[model samples]
Each structure stands twice: as structure tokens, then as C-alpha cells.
Target chain A: MASLYLIGIGPGSMDNLTGLAVKKLNESSVIIGYKYYINLIRPILKNKEIIESEITNEVDRAERAVLEVLNGKTVSLVSSGDSGIYGMAGLALEIISKKNIDIDVHVIPGISALNSAAALLGSPIMNDFCSISLSTNLTPWNIIEKRIMNAAEADFVIIFYNPKSMRRQNGIVNAMEIIKRYRNESTPVGIVKNAYRDGQEVILTDIKSMDYNTIDMFSTVIIGNSQTYLYKDFMITPRGYSKKYEY
Target chain B: MASLYLIGIGPGSMDNLTGLAVKKLNESSVIIGYKYYINLIRPILKNKEIIESEITNEVDRAERAVLEVLNGKTVSLVSSGDSGIYGMAGLALEIISKKNIDIDVHVIPGISALNSAAALLGSPIMNDFCSISLSTNLTPWNIIEKRIMNAAEADFVIIFYNPKSMRRQNGIVNAMEIIKRYRNESTPVGIVKNAYRDGQEVILTDIKSMDYNTIDMFSTVIIGNSQTYLYKDFMITPRGYSKKYEY
Candidate 1:
């Protein structure tokens, strides 16, 4: 049966691609993705037919993939990070359901930015954590702020995706202010830019000293919980081992 | 430089192993992990010296891995999910730091169970979400309950890791009661057991009708926020796209 495979390429590097993801991509007859993501996987795309579209045209891209699948072509819709998390899988499934299209949609998970950033920044997410996208394009700023405030109050290791953009100048700063309401000023903050890609940068700072000027859409920001601390250059949150077991 | 590598072998299947993780496992001279996890990766451990320990002996396993690295042997400490999240990375680093062992530590991230579960259950985590483990072995029950309540009140999609075990029977039931105080009883809940492995089961039901009997340590439970719904056997949470764009 022909199917539409939603594959996450995992930080845009072939090294991070899972063996299942690579096999599905190779088996796909056609590939569809945002223009930037398409270029990121160009090295492995070989002879597959590629369809590039604008980032804003997610619905259109999803509809096109479903249409191709219905036409008996194996389609691979690519996205960075896990396709199920803030990626193309949701939109594609919505389109298929609305159109009543008969097709098999397989969502293949990958290493999201949260995973890559957490690895670089030690174990900040070793415990409970929440992730909220700071981009207000699709979600309202007020809703985003409320989520951040609640997560902060709960002392979750908070992760902010798409922290800053060209038009949205004050999102990260505003988020930090809300976070400071419940967290200490010295809480560890990890900023990872272009993770697992070229020009990758990992910065460790405190909530009070975080430099938002260097953050952009390509970065993922993590604010550690109250228990998080820095040992040498590594930012770590103990997984309750110190309290439960003696070293 | 001799290094200790912490690798997450995603879902304990060779297919889900990333290319980088596979390379590191192959390059390492010694591999160490929990007894169950070591058995899961037996196919790839043809030539490497394998060391297995009981699940309760995480500190002992971590210390042994660090000792091997200090003795100039390349070692890989394997974990089932993203190693930085509830894995051996933090314990090993803590041991190395305390013992004043000078060795390079590299954490290779993989697809966590949450990611794999979300993919199988559709995109229930497409929006803002948080994950909390139900195990109270290390964390106090009060703290765990508070985090679940706050996440529920904030309407963040909640993922529960280690939802149940033989000894702890009432954790999931207690968690569901707290969540019901904030969310509607009809809220979507997805239970994925042994995701991407043998005997995998995906169940989509409502909060009022969830069956805890089928859940175990290998399962991941996702309780969707107020906005999540089930459409054609797929549990989905909108990414605020329907409100932002006309589809």
C-alpha cells in the first residue's frame, strides 16, 4: 500500500538520522518539505523528486502530500526535529481527515531540538519539563505568556522554541521576566543555536545574565528548574539521585 | 582523548538507533548498561566487551564506566531513551566530577519514548506540553502531584513516564484524579505500550474511560489538554493553525 511518511530529519544532519527514517526516505518516490529543510537534507535526497514550498504554506504542502499519496505515489513529507512536535505531521493529518482521504500516514519520530540541546547543556531535562514555542505567529502572546508563567510556577525545566524572530523582538525578554517571578535570578539558562548543525553555539548563563541579543529563530533556550546547578562547564539537574541514594 | 559516551538507543530497537549512536557504539571498546538494556542491544555487541548490572545499581554501573574511561578505554554507557532525560548521563558525570576523573564526556541524544509515543498516537504533543514521571521512588509524592496539577490547570498536554509498576499501584489513578479537577472528563488520553517494539499497543480513549490495567513500566501515557480531540482513531491537538490560518 502506498503511504505518506512524515519523517523528521533530526537537526538537519545525516548523522542524527535514524536508520528507520533513512530507509523510509529512500523508499519514498517523492519528497516534500519547506525550502530550508529541503536544502538541509539535499545530500541524501539523491534522485527523489523534491517539492519545495514556503514555510507559511504548511497547509498547502500538507494537502499536496496527501494528494500525491492518493495518486498512488509513496510520499515523504520532511520536517526538522520530531515531525509530531510542532512539525508537519499535525497539519498533514488534519488535511487528510478533513478531505476524507484514504491513506496511511506514518509519523516517524526523530531527535528534536530539545533532545540535542539537553545533551549539550548537560541534563537540564533530567526531571519534569515543559516546552512552549515563543513564536506568537500562530499562538497568541497572552496564551504563551500564561503557559510560561504556569510552567515557571511549577518549577519545570522550561524550554522555549523559536525564541526570537525578526519581527518578534521582545518575546524572550518578556518570557524571562515572567519566569523570574517564580524562579531565582541565578537560575541556569542554556542557549543552543543551530544545534547539531554548522555554526552551532552553546552558551551557559544565569536568568539574570542571559543575553537575548544573540538568540534568534534558530536557537532553543532552556531555563533550568530550582534544583539545576553548574558543575565545571556542565549545567545539570540531578535526577533525585543525590536525595535517594548516597554517592 | 579517552572519553565516556552516554548514548540513548531509542525504543531499544536497532531501527530507531541514529547513525551517530550506532557509530559510537561500534567505536567503543567496552559497552555497559542495565541488564535488560544490554540484552536489547545484543545484536550489535558482537565484538565489544559487555558489562551488565541490575537496574537498582545505576551508581555502580556509572562508576564502572567512568573507571574504564579513566583507564584509557573508550566506553559507551547505554540508556533506553534520551540519556540526558532520566538516563545515566547525569549519574556518570556526577561520579566523574566527585572522583576528580579527567575524561571527556559526550552525550548522544536519541528519540525519547515521549517522542515515539506521540508519533504513534498522532500529534497530541504538537502544542505546548510537559512530561512528568509518575514514579515517586526519588521524588516525593506531594511534589509529583503538584506538578501534575499545575500542568493540568495550565492545559499543557501531559506525558507520564513510568506510569505504573508492580509495587506502586495507585500512582496513575491518583494522577488522573488530580488532572480531572482541571480538565474535562472527556479529554483525550493516549496510552502507548512498548512503542515501536514487539507487542506495541496504541489506545485512544477519554480521561473518564482510561484503563490503567493495561499500562506498565514500558508504557507512556499522554493525557491531552482541553483542546485535544480524537478524529478517526487519531488523537490530535491543534497547533493553533485552524485559528491562525483558514484551512
Candidate 2:
């Protein structure tokens, strides 16, 4: 049986790659992913056939991976974070189902940007947290706005992926405004750029004074809940231990 | 400077260990964790001094790690999932902060159970999602209930960690009831037990007919949002590619 592996190579760093991910990538004959992701793993793709495509051609990339698998090539479709979360796994499965392709698909989980960012910024996500992507390319801005509003109202430690981009300037600022209505302007916000990768920058700022200019498409923004606080230089969200456990 | 490492050994399996994690563990002079988690990493703790403690003694275990570090021993405090997310990272940091301990603490992120569960059940968490631990040990039930309600109301996919236990049998049931108020009873729900570990099990069912008997403390349950759907044996939440792009 032909196998198509959807592998998440965490945060574009060799240090973050799991042993299983490295083994599977080594075993795969062909690697398919966006040009940036492909180049990120170029050091490991010594003899493997590489298939690169533009970022906008996600469906096409998924279809190509499925086609490669159907053609009897063991293919690995790569994504930056956990492939099941806003990655290539969904698209590949959808393509396979749509075309009635029979192939063994396995999703190899990897550390997500949220996990990497949370570790770098201390434990801001120690309790209930929700992730919202601010990109308005696939999802409408109105829908994104509603999610941010409800998440804020719910007091969820909100993590924003794709928070800002070159063309979409006001997306994150608008989302922050919605969050401000529910959370205090003094709520701690942690912004991480290129987590675990080169040129990494981690900043702990309040929601009101957050510098939008520092955030880019490569950055992840986390808006702390009402209970989150800053401890020294680290952002800490108490896991109700002080309230429940008398330590 | 004495070093204390807080490591997340993903899903309690050697296969999921990252290269960096393995290196750090090998370098540590002592391994400290809960009994269950310590046993999970026993295979790699050949020469390291093992300090196993009961599950209820989280603060004690963290303090012990700090004490070991203070004694000039490189200590590795291991957790099952991402250490920063409801794991030992916050507890260890709190202990250090309270005591004003000056030790170099490094948190190594790992593949969380939520990531493993999402991969096994298809891409049910491709969009915005929230994780809430149902255990009321450290957090009040009212807070957990409110988070569940808000997550469901916002239509964010909900992942419940530590969903059920022998004494707390009604936690998940109560959580589902809160979700039912916002989402339909027929919404897709995924239950994964021992994800990526021995005796792994994955079940996909709807919110109305989900079998509570099958869930336990080891299980991670994911309740899909309004946009989630089931295709064949797989659960999927689209990232809005089909609605936005024509491939």
C-alpha cells in the first residue's frame, strides 16, 4: 500500500524535530511543501525528490502529494506546525476524499508555534486557552472578529496566529480592540516572532501599548486573560493554585 | 549556575522525543517526575537518579527538583505533555519565584496530547480551538464550566484534558451539558485514549450519543464546533479553503 505522511516540522528548527519526524522524512522518497518550508528542511533532503509550490497553491500542493502517492511514491507532505492544525493534513485528506484515492495517510504530530511561544514567554497558557488566526485570506474578517470577541468575553487566554501580514495591517489592531472590550487594557500580551527559529524575538507588553509594528506574518501574539500577570520579566497565568491549593 | 530542565516528553512515548529533548535528558544527572510519568521515561534514565513522587504532590516534586538543582545537580523535571501547558512548568516556576531561587530553568517543549489526538481523529482542530482541563483539583468547577460555555458559544473546537476520573465522574458529563446549550447534540466529538502510547484508542462519535463509559483520566476528548463534520471514518474542520479558493 502506498503511504502519504503529513509531517509537522516544528517551528523551522532542527532542534525541534522529533526523532520520528526525522526517521520518516529520511524514509520518504519525495517531499512536497511550500518553497519556504521546503528550504527550511533542505539540509535533510539530501537525496529525496523535492516538490516546491507557492503558498497560495495549497489545494494544488495537496493534490500533487496525493497524486504522487497514487503513483507509488512514498510522499511526505510537510507543514511548519502540527499538520492537523491549520496545516496540510486537512487539505490532503479532503483532496483524497474528493478524488476517491485510496492511500494510507498518517499525521505525525509536532510541537506547534503555540507550544514554542508559550515556553519562551513562561506559562501564560496554564489554563483554558483558545487559538485564533487573524489572517482574512480564507476566513472573512467579520467571522474572525466574532471569534476574537467571544473568546475575549469567555476569558480565554487567546493565541493569535498569522496575526499580521504585509497587506493586512489593521487585522490584529481591530482584533485587539474587540478583546479590549472584554479584557482590561492592562492585560498582559506576549508577542513572539519566529519562535525557535532564527531572528527570534519575544516581548511581554500590555494589550493597550502593544506595538503593532513589531508583529508580522511570522509572529504569534498571545493576549492574556483577566487573571494573567507579569512576574518579573515572564508572563504567568496562575493555574488557580493560589486559589485552590494553600501553598 | 545550577540548571533545572522542565521537559515535556510528548504522549509518554520514546518515539515522540525530540533530538534536543533526548540530549538534555542524557545530560541531566537526576530525573524527577510523577510516578506514572517517571515510569514512562524509565527506559532512558539508565544512570540518572530517579525521584518519583505521587501525582498529588506536584508542588513537592517541583520543590525537590529545585532543591536538587540547588545542590549542584543538573535536574530534569519531566511532564507528559507540553510542560508549559497545565504541566509542571508553572508549578516549578512558582516554587522558584516564591523561594527567590536563582537557578537556570530551561523549558523544552514537546508534542502535546491535544496535537496527537487531533492527528489521530483527522483535522478537527484545523481552525480556532480551546483546551480546558476538567479536573477541579486546582481550579474551581465554576471556572471550568464558564470556560466550556464560552468556548462552545464562540464555536471554537474544545479539547478536554483530564476529562474524567473515578471520583470526578460527572465532570465531562457536566461539560457536555454546557456545550449542548450552544452546539447541537449531533456535533462531532472525538475521544482518544493513551494517544500515541501503548493501548491507544480513537473513537469518533456525536455529542448526543457519546459513550461516557469509554472515557477516563487518560483520555483526551475533543468536541468539534459548528463547522466541523465527519467524512467516512475521519473527523474534519475545514480551514475555509473550499469556501475561499477554487482548486
Candidate 3:
């Protein structure tokens, strides 16, 4: 049986890549990933045949990767972030299962951008949180709106992925308005720009006090729940732990 | 002013670590982390001093790392998972802020255990999810129960970290019972043993069908929400996409 490795390269860091992922990348003759993501790993790839695609062309990459793996060459498909989190792992598995190529598919997990971005800012994710991508690529805005409302109603910490681009800069404002409909305006908000990257910047603000215009495509916004507090300049979402609670 | 780097190592992988994190790691001369995590990257240390500790010793590690960084050495205190997710980034900040360290604190983001365990289990974490660590070291069970209730009520995809050990083998069963209070028995559950490492196994079961006695310390379990489905040997927590409104 032929084999395929669906590798998660993490949030663009070489060391954060697992030993297994690196071994697969080195052993596999063919590598498939988004062109931008491919560019990030070109320096590390050792004489591998790379297949790069655009962002919206996930199915094409999966198809090509499966075909390449079926040809009896150790082929590896790469995905930026955890791949399971809004990345190409699911789509690849779907296509692979559909093809039924007697291939042993291996998935090596990596860090998602949200966790990386959240780490860049303090403990904004220490509470019960939900991650919602603002892009309407797969789900409808109404359902997205309802999820946002449910998040707001439940006072769950909210992590907004794919926050904005030139065409959809207004979606974040709409999300904030909906959140404010149920949550307090003083709820803490954390914006991580290019988190875990060269030009990283972290901003801690509030829902009502946010300057929406400052955010962009590379930024991820983490809005804290009602009980989240800002202590010693850190955005802390208390897990409700401490010695005082031990009765 | 001296600075301390609170770096999230992201599941014992170098390539899975971020470029920004690598930059900070490169700058630091003293490294502090669990002995195993430090040993994972021993080749890259290049003669850097390491203060390795056991995984459970948090406050002591933070104090020692802070002291090293305060003494004019650039110290890198590493944590598995995102640094702030039950990690040392916050605890370090809390200690340093009180000591007047006049230090620059940088948190380098890494891959978290939730995403790693999820990716190992095929498409298990595709929808709304919350992560709860059953290690009640400092966190109380009452708050953990509330989070479980909230997750069950929201029908969120739930990932249980540190699920079972020799002493705490019943954590998942207790959590499942709490979840069953709000969720049904048919919800899909996935358990990934030894996630992101050698000898990893992914188990696909459900709330009513799972056996807790078989799990060990290395296992991380995930429970799918109401809309979750299993198709072609892959678990999917559909985000309510692929179904459009009839206008």
C-alpha cells in the first residue's frame, strides 16, 4: 500500500515542526501546500518536488497530493497552522477517502494560529472560548451570526479568525455590535497582529473602546468573557482557579 | 531593563514552532522547560545553559527562570502547548510583575495540545470546541463542572487534556457524565493517545460507547457536538456548513 503524510507545519516556524513532520518532509519526494505556505518552508525542504497552490484551491492540492502519493513515491502534503483548524487536513481526508487509494494517510499536527496569537498576548484564552471564522467561504453569515450571538449570550471568549481584508473590513464591526447586544461594552478584547512572526504587535482593548480601523487580514482578535480581567497589564481570562476556592 | 522570554514550544517540535519564537529562542542564553522538552531540541542549544524541571513544577520553575533572567541573562522559559494554556507564561508574568524585574516579557506562541490531539484523530475538532484539563492541581472541580455544563449546553466540541493518569483514571467518565446531563449519548468521542509522538493511536467512540479503563496518561479525548457525524472512517464536526437556507 502507498502512503501519504498530511503534515501540519505549524504557524510558520521550523523548530515548532515535529520530528515526524520533518522526517516526512525529508523522506517524501513530493510536497503539496499553498504557495505562500510553501514559500515559508522552501528553505527547509531537502530536494523535494513541491506542488504549490493558491488559498481557494485546496481540493486541487488534495487531488494532486493523492495522485502523487498513489504513484508509490513517499508524498507529503503540508498545511499551515494545525490543518485541522480551518486548514486542508479535512478536505484532504475527504478527497483521499473518495479516491480510496490503498494509501496509509498520516497526519502530523501543528500549532494553530489562534493559540499562537493568543500566546503572544497573555492568557486571553484561559476561559471557555469559541473560534469563528468571519469568512463566509463554507458557512452562511446568518449561521455565523447565530453562533456569534450564542457566544455572546453564553459570554464565551470569542476568537475571530480571518478577521478582515479589503473587501470585508466591516464584518468585524458587525460582530462587535452583535456581541455588544448581549455582552458588556467593557469586555476585554485582544488583537494580535502577525502573531508569532517578525512584525508581531499585541493590543489589549475593550469592545466599546476598540478602534476597528486598526485591524487587518493578518490580525486575530480575542474577546474575553464578562469575568475576564486585566491585571498587571495582562489580559487574563481566569479559569476560576486559585487557593481561595478550595473549600 | 532586562527581559524574560516566555516561549511556547508547541508540542515538542521545532518546525512546528513559529519563526518569531525561534528568533526569541535564538536570543536567549538560558533555557527553562521540562527536561524532556528541553532534550527534544538539545542539538540547537549550542552551549546554552538549561534549567530543566519536572512538568508539574510550575511556580518553582517560574521563580527560577525569572531569577535567571533578572540576573542579566536572556532566559527562555518554555512551556508545552500555548504558553498561556495551563502553561507558565501567565505565572511567570505574575511573579515578575511583583518583583519589579524591569524586564521585557515576550511570549512566543507554539502549537497547543488540543490542536495536536485533534489532528491526530482525523477531523474530530471541526466545530465549536472547548479544552478542559482534568488535572485539578490548582483548578477546582466546581468550576470545571461549570465549564463542562457550559460546553454541554452549547453543544461545543470538547477536548479533554490531561484526561487520565494512574490516579485520575475516572476524570473522563466523570466529565462524560456531566456532559450527558446536557448532551446525548450519541455524540461522537475521539481519544488520541500519545498525540504528536511515536506510537500514537486515535480512538473513535461516543459518549455511551467509550470505555474509560483502557485510557492512560498519554490519552487526550475529544467529544463531538450534536451535529457531528462520522463518514468513511473519519469523524467530522460539521460547522453547519454545506446546508444553505432556502430563500
Best by DockQ: 1
lDDT on C-alpha atoms for all candidate structures: 0.90, 0.88, 0.74
Instruction: Return the top candidate by lDDT.
Output: 1
> All models, DockQ values?
0.82, 0.76, 0.34
Q: Model 1, stretches more than 4 Å misplaced? A: none
For model 1, what is the alpha-carbon lDDT of residue A20?
90
Chain B only: TM-score of model 1: 0.97
**C-alpha lDDT of residue B67 in model 1:** 83
Q: Cα lDDT of model 2 overall?
A: 0.88
Superposition error at A29 for model 1 (Å): 0.6
Give one digit per residue, the lDDT tens place, for model 1 in A136-189.
988888889889988998889999998999899899999998998899999999
Q: Please give, as one word, the docking class of candidate 1.
A: high
The Cα error of candidate 1 at residue B119, in Å, is: 0.7
Question: How well is each residue in A1-247 modelled by candidate 2, as lDDT tens digits?
Answer: 6789999999888878888888889889999999998888899898999999998889888988888988999999999988988899988877766666678888888889898899889888888899999988888887788888878887889999998888999998898888878988899999999988889999999988999999999999999999888877678887867665655
lDDT of 1: 0.90
* Predicted candidate 1 versus true structure: per-residue lDDT over B1-247, tens digit per residue: 7888899999887889999999999989999999888888799887999999998899888989988988999999999988988888888776666666678888999889988999999889999999999999888899899899889888899999989987998999999999989989999999999888888999999999998898888899999988888888788888877776666
